[model samples]
Target: MKLFFRLAKYLTPYNNYVIGAAISMLIFSLCNIAMIPLIARLSEAIAQKSIFQLNLVVAMAVGIYFLRGAATYGQGYLISFASQRMLFDLRTQLFEHLNKLSFDFFQKWRTGDLISRSTNDIDNIQNGISSTVIQLLPNMLTLLGAICYLFYLNWKLSLLTLMIIPLLSLIINKFGKEMHKVSSDAQKKTSDISSILQEKVAGVQVVKSFAMEKHEIKKFKEESEKSFWLSLKQVQINVTQTPLLAFIQVLGMVAIIWYGGYQVVTGKLNPADLIAFFAGIALIADPVSRLGDTNAIVQRSLASAERIFEIIDLEPTVQDAVNAHDIEIKGEVRFNSVSFKYQEELPLVLEKVDLKANPGEIVALVGRSGAGKTTLVNLIPRFYDATEGEILIDNIPIRDSKLHSLRSQMGIVSQETILFSGTIKENIAYGKIGSSDEEIKQAAIAANAHNFIIELEDGYETVVGERGASLSGGQKQRVAIARALLRNPRILILDEATSALDTESERLVQEAMDKLMQGRTTFVIAHRLSTVQHADKIIVLDRGKIVEQGKHDELLSKSGIYKMLYEMQFKEPA
Candidate 1:
């Protein structure tokens, strides 16, 4: 009964179905308990009477069993269906909320950790939904019904057994908190270890080049040891709870036997009634043991729910305004008096610098690494919000526009071209899902990628390896270009798009870009000055401040940083 599982609100919408399922489960519990009295009667009859009466009792028991089985099935199916549907809806809800979260959330989290929460953590919650809530409720009802009947059979014996119930409850409740703490600690360490392993594996080449195999292994050993100790402690606690509870159960059973024996000796209780009391004790013991075990499961589930719910309950930083209306954009982007720092206390990465790219102008941003070139262009797409100042797309402040509508008009190609594991056609079509095959091919051709694509055995059907490792650096860039081309956006941002390739590849990318930039408003970030020499406007940044802004020739004549950079690059030997 967490806020999230308050499916009372959700079920209210499906109240009729929920009510029917609950009623069916209650009826099943009732029927199951009803069999206990009939069982005691049959046992007593057999104890007193001969085989002549046994046939009728046996037939009645068989019929009752079959009817109970049918009711149980209905109860199980309805509860399982509702629980799974609730989990499905919860997953969708979490993912939807995640889609709204700001870039800072992703920046601070490890991909592997988030993935584990959505998969493994959510799965734990699902188990709680399926078995814990749905099944526990029914079992408790059955146990309660059985206790009532036992009380009716012999009130003194019922009181004796019931006296031990409070002790069992206290024991489990105490142990449950301990299990939750240990389990949560263990699970967090496990997620951290997984993320570390993933990072090491993904960057194996870097690890190898740095010869940090032993170092990495040592780090893993430390984390693995921590995880081991935590997990072992968690399991130890869980394993002891049950046996200790069972030992206490044996004491309860001994008390029942001793008290009942004295009563029978005094003729206070009949032999059949004493036996039936124990039988009822056996019935109570099963549910009691199961409920105790379920407490452990609930502890683990609550721990998992904390992780899963973290993402689900996260507040998105960059959500669209509630009263804002979607605007039809013409891609006239402007950054006015913008200043941004990753963390508020950190130094500003971009200062109060005004910049703009009028529709169809190819603006170039050139700077050394960490000069905040990427950070500047990233604002146009609202990937990260500016700490101070307005980013306007077609004169509308980005905070006031619909997120999807604003993003749809923009396309980005980064320095490292990322390709999906799919056919070449599929990769290009990723730029615009549902684009026709002909459209995809044309986009590839526009990016100077069509010839090589067709040269492959299956043409557009040729499968690209993971991360497009099968393709050459140049081919990957062209494919990325084709992807952006297919987007057919009003604004195109290329961050060192051709930096990964050879001269031949660069030439091909440049030619494709010429076509790509014909009418599109494009922002280019390049360290190689020769690449941006022909840009309509070149903005040069030193530190977080813009030092120069003009066409190439104008800046070159000024004999400043741009002139110095151009001469250094253009004068180099080929």
Candidate 2:
């Protein structure tokens, strides 16, 4: 109910359309009810051989239907227009809200589930409100109008017909509860299926490499079958609901025919009146049966609405403070008494870590995997805040700085290069939007990527596939470096940026890295000991704690953790 109210607020701007639809629906219902008397008049005219009366009745019926058609068109058009606009606005808000969420939120929610909430769940609400609810109003009005006319024709018969309504309502209530539960389960299963497909499709290369295509197909089949069964259960409820309601209506109709016919035979009622009353009773039956189906749709939509609001209601753990201000940085960064754990129950990934990199200095972090090298650098950009203590830029805590301004001053290039599907020029110019062609070319040349980019058939216009899959490992890394360089950030982070390259490719990328690092506060996380040999200072970490700190040569002379790691990498292989 809360979510429904929230969603309804989106309709405020288009209330006029809703109003138009409601008015049209009412007019349409009145036109339909006007047919009952015309039908009654036609029956009387036929019995009396009154051709002129019959012609007048036929003309009146035609005019009533014509107005009904016009009203129906107005109702359909206005409601559909309003519903589509609401869908657009709601989807836009959902996507924008998603972008504001923190990394932890993405970690907790599966991509498939999020996609389902954004797409399928939203679609469910649209269909339920626009199609089901729009039609439901008219069906209910028609049912009411029919009941009133039945009572006018014969009070006793109408009272008997309405007696069955309470029983039908009870049945509808029971089926509605069961249907909502089944529909919610089915939607979850649908999300699970989406998750499997998203995961498998993104990792198709691994599946093919491991020859696990059959295994993946089997897993998908199992999930799909579960979704199918859940849908089947919902279908069973839907199929059962309409027939059960119809059966109840049929019982009422049976009593009406037996009593109304006896009244006509006993000369207690005229044939035309009896026929008109029967017509109204028949009119009530279809809409009443349809109401049961619409209730199920409403239930399913409510279930979907719950799923969508769950994400919208979440507050991001990482957000700029209300008083946060933009600051101009000078490439100096400090981490003081910093500690971090992904979650409180987990062991700290960084423990009381203290570090500093002054303007135009190169600090290299050399550590084994899982030693918190990436985690340590991640705090500088506020990807995750320190669990204890604080990080500062030029003596001011980063927490006091606006997020966009703070992040805009730094650039990162990780081991796994991520480039969206777009032209090479677009990808290179991504960091600096509205960058001219010359600026893009300059950035590419600085990264040593221009030569190969121009050599391609489309030159800078060549389209990179998803994740830059069309490009080689070295090419993708250089492109990523170009993107970072284009931003012209004061601070830079290179996390094993060239670890995946061959000897020749590494030399080219290293040359580009040297160019990018000049005049910037650079933090390098490297597996290859040779790359960090010229660093101003080297920090060695082991199990989330700094074990050694000095120049690369000084660390080697110490013969400690750094020396052991250097020896392991450079040792003679027999």
Candidate 3:
């Protein structure tokens, strides 16, 4: 009930349309109620053979029905228009809220589960508000008018009809709870299936390589069967309850006909009045059954609303401070006793780290797999804030600067390049929006990518497949470098950038890297010891602590961790 009221707030903006719908519904209800009693009068007029009176009754019936049709159309149109506008507003809010969420939120929730909430869950809300309520409102109004008319004709008979109300309410309450539970379970099953489909489709190469096609199909079928059974249960409740409520109403109708007939035969009432009373009872039955179905619709929609609000209610852990502002950067980055862990319960990934990179210096990080090489550089960008202590850029704490302003001064290129599904030119230009054609070409040339790009059939206009599948990995890395160069940041981070490429590709990418590193504060995480040999300063980390720091040769001569790593990589096998 509380959830339903909260959803009603969306309808306030379209109150004028609601007003129009209400007015039309009122007239439609009055016409329906008036037509029932008029039927009794028409029967008498025909029995008397009075042609003039009979014609008058017949004409009024036609006119009333014509008005009813127009009113029904108007109410339906207005209500539908308002409901659709509400849906648009709600969907936009949900999507915008998703964008404001932090990186960790995406890591925790499955992609398919989020997509299902945004699409399928919202559709359920739409059905409840737009389709069910539109019909439900008119039925409820007509039912009320029919009950009033039944009482005016004979209070005893009306009171007898009212006896079924408590039983009907009990039935709706019992089954509505069951329906809500099943609906929530069914929606979750759908989300699970969607997750499986997305994972299998996106990782199709892995599945095919492992020959798990049969395994995947069997899993999918089992999930589908679960959803099917849940849906059948929901349908069973709906189908069973509608007739059960209708049968209860039929019991009331039976009692009314028997008692009213006895009154007429005993000279206690007119035939026409008894006949009109029965018509009113009949009128109320249909709407009562329709309203029972509406109860199930409401329950299903409320279940969906709960899931959607869970996302909307979430507050992002990472957000800009109230006093944060943009700052000018000269690429001097410092880490002062910075320590970090992804979560509070986990051990530190980086412990008591202290480092500095002056303007226009190349600092290369080299270490074993579990060492905090990448985590140390990630502090500069504030991807995850330091668990203890602070990091500074250009003599000011990074926490005092706006997130976008700080990140805009830096660029990154990773071993696995992420290229969107778009033309080659568009993908490169994404680094700097509104970049010109000539500027994009210049960046590509600097990364040694311009020559190969021009050799393609469509040149810069070639559409890269999903994650740039159409291009070889070496080509993708080059494009990534071109994108970084376009940003023209004062600081850059390269994480195992050329470690995955062949010898020829590595040479070309290395040349591009050398060109890009000039006059910038660069942090390089290198797996191949040869790549960092010329770095202005080399920092060797072991177990999340800096073990050595100096020029490449200076560190190598000391017989420390750096020397051991160098020998492990470049030494000839015995």
Clashes of each: 0, 0, 0
Residue pairs with clashing backbones, model 3: none
- Go through the candidates in order and give the C-alpha RMSD of each one to the true structure: 2.1, 1.7, 2.3
| lDDT against the true structure, each candidate | 0.83, 0.90, 0.90
**Tens-digit lDDT string for candidate 1 (353-391):** 798889888999987678889999988878888999898
Candidate 2's C-alpha runs over 4 A off are none
The global Cα lDDT (0 to 1) of model 2 is: 0.90
Ranking by TM-score: 2, 1, 3
Report model 2's TM-score to 2 decimal places: 0.96
Provide the clash count, candidate 1.
0
Candidate 2 lDDT for residue 527: 97
Model 1 / residue 241 / CA error / Å: 0.9
Off by over 4 Å in 3: none
TM-score of 3: 0.93
Candidate 3 lDDT by residue in tens digits, 1-574? 7898888888899999989999999999999999777978887887788898889999999999999999999898998898889888888889999987877789899999999999999999998895455878888889899989888888988899899999998998998999999999999999999999889998999999999999999999999999999999999999999999988888878888899999999999889888888788778877888766888888888899989999999987776889999997899989899888878898998888889999999999999998999888777887778899899998999989998898898999999899999999999998899999999999999999999999999999999999999998889999999999999999999999999999999999999999999999999999998998998889999989898999987997898999998898889989
Q: After superposition, how far is residue 553 of candidate 3 from its true place, in Å?
A: 1.3
